[model samples]
Target: MTLDTWTTRLSRSLLVNGLPREYVCRTTREMADHLEDMRDSEGDDDASRRLGDPDTLAQMLTHGFRRQSLFGRHPFLTFWLSPIPIATFLAHIVYLFTIELIMPVVVRLYGESEVAFVSGSLDATKVVLVLAMHLWLQAIPVLLTMRLYRIIASRAARPWTSIIPAMILFLLYFSMTKFELTWPSGTNPGNYRIDIGTVSGFSSQPVTQGLQALFVALVCILWLYRVAGEQSSERESAVTAIP
Candidate 1:
């Protein structure tokens, strides 16, 4: 196979097996460059044989990947949040629909002033608020999913064990732009023009979403810690009284 073809297969396999995107991209880029140069000087036959199977290469990369993960101890939890990027895409689509369709109808019924606000160019402040609010709504389901996963994972380990996966997913979700899901088309949630300064800008929705996720995580972690501490105290007191 050509260097490009081999690299493509290796990249796909590593990504499919749940290597973090940053690590996968960086590692694959270096591997591809090295292989391409090797093929250039040494020819295809030796490089192909030495590299062995692309599948095996991906497995070796991913086996080492697991060792480096924040949630390395809980493979199931890491696997559990594997689909979160897809979920983020789906949720954003839903958010877009609600803002585009239902919101217009609701504003129309309110009054002419509100109707104008809906149709007219929004100022920076309003656009910021709108985007932040919409993103929060989109993030609600994700937060619930995280919490539920933590509850389920508590049986296997401490509840906080689930937070790393949830936090990683949250970071990925918040880091992405409209490009991830709607690069060339579709209405971007925050990519509207603000009337205040005639400024067209991407909204601070990502930061808002990050803050929301962090808040939820903090609350859950502290709550779990407090409960565990209380339970530990109770167990110690009971043991002492029995003695």
Candidate 2:
């Protein structure tokens, strides 16, 4: 086949492979005009050359089309290439260690001034309960990351777009929970209260928590989106360059 024909064929295949099965034929057809235009461009010859051979082109098309990991790839590379799952797992661990273990001990050690302002023994109990709730909240993102990874791995779809929806969900959940936790005097039901006598600081603890969650979630989302966009764009550029 001519280089132009190969360019059109391979680009179409890649676009098709990068989409879900149900969208495969649709995506292929949608890309046909663009791929043909790419072939007609003066740069098409150079672009087709980079695709290597039929075997390599086929492998690229098949990649992420299946739900399995690329066999024999380096484990270290996978961690970097697919960092979402690892990051999610680490976030859960931090939540457990900080809230379940560290925060309670710190609360006990520093007196009420060092901790969130709560009223009576109920404050202490609420603190514990709130911490637990926070930990549970983190699981949402972790689960989202896992689902995102599976979708990208299976369909070769852009994972970065997935982060956008996940982040929207995260922000909404945190906002709702923060409001719920704060309105009741920033106290949740639990074993003990804040020992109102030891309290200081006029800050609204619930608001602080909410703002913190918002900041962190926003940062994560933005960073993920930028990275995903960059990588996706680079793939498209590569396809265009190969002739």
Q: Global lDDT of each model?
A: 0.53, 0.47
Candidate 2 per-residue lDDT over residues 160-214, each given as its tens digit: 3434544454444333333223333445433322211111212345565556456
Name model 1 segments beyond 4 Å from true. 1-74, 77-86, 89-106, 109-119, 124-129, 155-158, 177-243
Model 2, position 38: C-alpha lDDT score: 62
> Which residue pairs does candidate 1 place in steric collision?
none
Which tens-of-lDDT digit does each residue in 1-243 have in candidate 1? Answer: 766666667766654554544565677678777777777887754435667788898888776755654555565645465547544655566566666775666556544455465555444655554565545544554555555545434333233444565556654454342311112233533234211111121254455335544654564456557655764564344323321
Give residue 232's error in model 2 in angstroms: 3.8
lDDT of 1: 0.53
Clashes of each: 0, 16
User: Looking at candidate 1, what is the lDDT of residue 68?
Assistant: 56
Best model per lDDT: 1
- Return the TM-score for each candidate structure: 0.37, 0.37
